[model samples]
Target: MKPTDYINEWVNRITPYSPGKTIDGMTKLASNENSYGPSPKVIAGLREKIPEVFRYPHKNLHVKEKLSEYCRVKPENIVLSNGSDEMIELIIKAFKGPIASIYPSFVSYPIYAQIYNREYISSSLNQDFSFDHRKFIKDAWKANLMFLCSPNNPTGKVIDVADIEEVAQTGKIVVVDEAYFEFYGTTAKHLLLQYPNVIIMRTMAKAFGLAGLRMGYAIADPELAEALKKVRGPFTTNYLAQEATILALKDLDYMKKSVSRIITDRKAIEKRLAEKYKITPSYTNFILADVSPMSSKEFFDRMLEQKIVVRPQPKFNGFEGNYVRITVGTSEENFLLLDALSKV
Candidate 1:
């Protein structure tokens, strides 16, 4: 039999989730990465900590300590990982739950759910691509684990706190993925005091400008937080990534400045696009644009030819047809994207 036939059923059945292109050879606005590189101090910190790479990393040390202080939570309440990607995978392995998430969410949830052979349920977003809390809560109650993205990926719509609280009351473990939190200026950290079952996941990749470092964290009650320790790969985080994150935390001012720029540019892009393209108000660093004039395939092809990459919404059940997710990029890059859109 072919190697494909011998592959695990779930693995063979899975359709890989597509990610945005690398910026190396293109005007990359496809992946929603912070255009501003890692905090300047992070570069300096990595140089200073280069020697730490020779020895095995200390189990619990400065990075976790500094992160806890920054997050205003106890060190015990945080579990750092290679990046938020590892955190998501850990959540799937640690919890035996019927996985549920709102549609047009971070693509990884369904990927991980299938990997674990768990029941994965999905609810659709509203027509405007905003989350409908009533449907979310209704579906969440039946799930053991639910992934909710704030300033939701691709769509860029944020759910109100009142609705988030209502869903938290569903009494299941609610994993809120705030990958784009800094861009939006909203958070679910306050909900942690009231909901013990809530796990707030934040990525250094998007807002902190540390996507290259691959570091992220989860905040939860210490008991529940510790449960994830089993799946956490010891030494999965490298010395450089740890050093970079600590420095990024120290340069909060620099991080905030970059975040401010992204917010400003996001609004500008939204307004310009809305004048001609069917664009929605995005609170995050990306916008979901419906290019119904062209078929989704044609839209994708045209953008690729222009060397600009954007995500196409998959036509799964309720989600159909030509919508592309455009990430906020630098002034020059955004202008390049505009130029391409103007032509198409």
Candidate 2:
């Protein structure tokens, strides 16, 4: 008779994804967002599109065309979504089979798989968080869908392209989440041509500084792209998001400049943090450091007392010791963070 009884048993067992917390006046470096923000042109353009909100969003043709050029794929090979998160869900919904990914990678891969009631499998990363392709391939052999994150979340480590190729050889639907590709400057796009089963997911949230607009896309073979379009809800991407993405794509230079700055700051933070903590080399705008000797929660709480926020990675599978993932903020914010770390 209870509403809970109506839910499937599998759905009841799922643990939802937890995002970083924010407090007023705190320097939030928890979530890996572009702190530099979007380009001036995108802001100006979005203001112009406000009055047009009365109308339904048009088909994603213009955005798709621009992204096609940006990604060097045909327009038909692209599918737009609310964000890359939705694209992940769509892929899970459209495909049927066990979902697999490496442990300590993107949390969404397994989380989404559970939401859709699909079997989720995972392989553990090496002690240093380095991925072993052969081990992953063997473990994920039974999976029909595989998700891989390069410049992986939390750790900011990139998967080698050769390892990606070896996984794609398994012939499963390989999803390469390149959400932070702009910072890393490499992609698995080359495999898309050779392997029709490959899907490359990207987002405007990171380097583009359009996290508020929630725009993401995927590039796949035209047939697979069409299938994803069928599964995704129509009008999921709104007018403002579409227009903002188009504007962001046009101002590639601004994004590149922001990325250059973040990368610089990322290195500075890594160098400083390495003096104490064991810092992992990063290709993205964030750094993961082993805060051993202090529990991750204790470190997080100490940062909190200073009104600074950073992500603790205790819940992620394969994380051996106390670790925290710090997003690279502006110069001022980074200075504040370092000052707080020293005092803590």
What is the lDDT of every predicted structure here? 0.82, 0.91
Flag clash pairs in model 1: none
Worst 10 residues of 2 by lDDT: 313-322
Candidate 1, position 248, lDDT: 84
Tell how far residue 235 is off in model 2, in angstroms: 0.9
Best by TM-score: 2
- Ten contiguous residues with the weakest lDDT in model 1: 313-322
Clashing pairs in 2: none
lDDT computed for candidate 2: 0.91
Over 219-243, each residue of candidate 1 has an lDDT whose tens digit, in order, gives 9888888888888888877777877
For candidate 1, the C-alpha RMSD (Å) to the true structure equals: 2.0
TM-score (all chains, Cα) for each model: 0.93, 0.98
Q: Which stretches in model 2 have alpha-carbon errors above 4 Å?
A: 315-319
Per-residue accuracy of model 2 over 100-161 as CA lDDT, tens digit each: 98888888888888898898998888888898999999899899999999989877899999
